[model samples]
Target: MSSRQNILTGSPWEDKVGYCRAVRIGNLIEVAGTVAIVDGETVKADDAYAQTKNIIERIGKVLEDAGASLSDVVRTRMFTTDINRFDEIGRAHGEFFKDIKPVTAIYEISRLVSPDYLIEIEFTAVVGEL
Candidate 1:
């Protein structure tokens, strides 16, 4: 039987919404949609690049807790309020995952949980033999 684990970031929303930041089932880890939220406040507000960077960093932490790394990430999905800012968002993503080169998709969304948020990202990772 496969074991399961839940990783939490202590976000109030996790409790209110009854969802964890990420879940690990055996070798696979699935991270929830993440934004540039720190200390219950949005960081980088309307900047897509900065927000993307922050969200990736946040996902990295959750992955670490789940016994995986960014290199283990096999896919990523990015949701942005403005597709025109793809250049900035893509640049930020490249800075982090350029080497790992995970499959990715960027979509223009009407909005996020917060209007101030410009980007949200979700990830999937498969842990390899250590």
Candidate 2:
């Protein structure tokens, strides 16, 4: 059996919300929805594109902690405040995933845990050959 492993980042919300950053079992890794917050402050507060990029970078580090790489990502789900920012969001996503080309979905949401957050993303990755 594949024992479960929780990839934790020590974000305060993790404890308050009772969830880890990601969970891995066997070869599968599921990353929780991530936003562009560092040191408790939102990154690129008003720029959707920059915020998306920051979120992806944060997700990248978490994925590595889960023993996976961006190339290993098979799918991604993104949620955003405004559909009008799709172009900015998509552009930032393309930069990280252009060659990897993971399956993706983007949805317009009313808001996030914090109003400062413009976007949130989740990832699914498979580690190693099947």
Candidate 3:
């Protein structure tokens, strides 16, 4: 069996909630729900499109740290506070995954950790031989 690895982001919530940003085992990497938080502040605030873009870029870094890349992503889950903004969110998502075409699901949620955060995303990736 492969050993487990944890990727931490040093977010206060990670330590308080006892969760890492991502975990990798064997050839699979699972990134935790991510928001557009940067330098201890939320980015893009109420903008779903920009928030989605930031979160995806953050996830990309986590994937790279786990020895994988966006192309290796097999699935994605997005949670948003506003379904009405889906078009914007979808556009941002398509910009990143249109070519890779990872299976994805977007859901409208009541809220997030912060009211300023409009979206949160999670990703699952499998590392294949390169």
Candidate 4:
């Protein structure tokens, strides 16, 4: 049978982007790269730390919706506009995954879909007996 699928929260972008918050394929759950946007715009400008925290929290919702927690996460990918902000983003990333110690990669990008976004993160989790 096909794996169950669901959206974690009711974000306007879910329909606009045509993607779910998290999709479960068999035992794997793939989460979309989440930013700190609350409505249609970024909430805190230049606050990469807070933005990172917000993004991770939003991702938490997606993981929870799929019957998984952050501990289930096995991998993560982070995208940032400025490499210099790695300290801020890395600390935030570490705060969440410190216990799980999931494989992670951070990249510096020219820009994100939105200019205000400083950091974006996506996670891959294996639920149930991983």
Task: Give the alpha carbon lDDT tens digit for every residue of 1-130 in model 4.
Answer: 7657875577787888787778887789999888886443445778788899898887887788888889999999999999899999889888988889999999999999888899888899998763
Model 4 lDDT, full chain set: 0.85
RMSD for each model, in Å, please?
2.4, 2.0, 2.4, 2.5
Query: lDDT per residue, candidate 3, 40-91, as tens digits?
Result: 3445576788888898888888888888899999999999999999999999
Where's the lowest-lDDT run of ten residues in candidate 1?
37-46
- Model 3 residue 64 lDDT score: 87
For candidate 1, write residues 31-114 as lDDT tens digits. Answer: 999888633344557678888888898788888899888999999999999999999999999999999999999999999887
**Which regions of candidate 2 deviate over 4 angstroms?**
38-42
Clashes of each: 0, 0, 0, 0
lDDT of 2 by residue, 48-93 (tens): 8888989888888888888888999999999999989999999999
Q: Largest lDDT belongs to which candidate?
A: 2
In the predicted model 1, the residue pairs found to clash are none
Candidate 2 clashes between residue pairs 3 or more apart in a chain or in different chains: none
| Span of ten consecutive residues with least summed lDDT in model 2 | 37-46
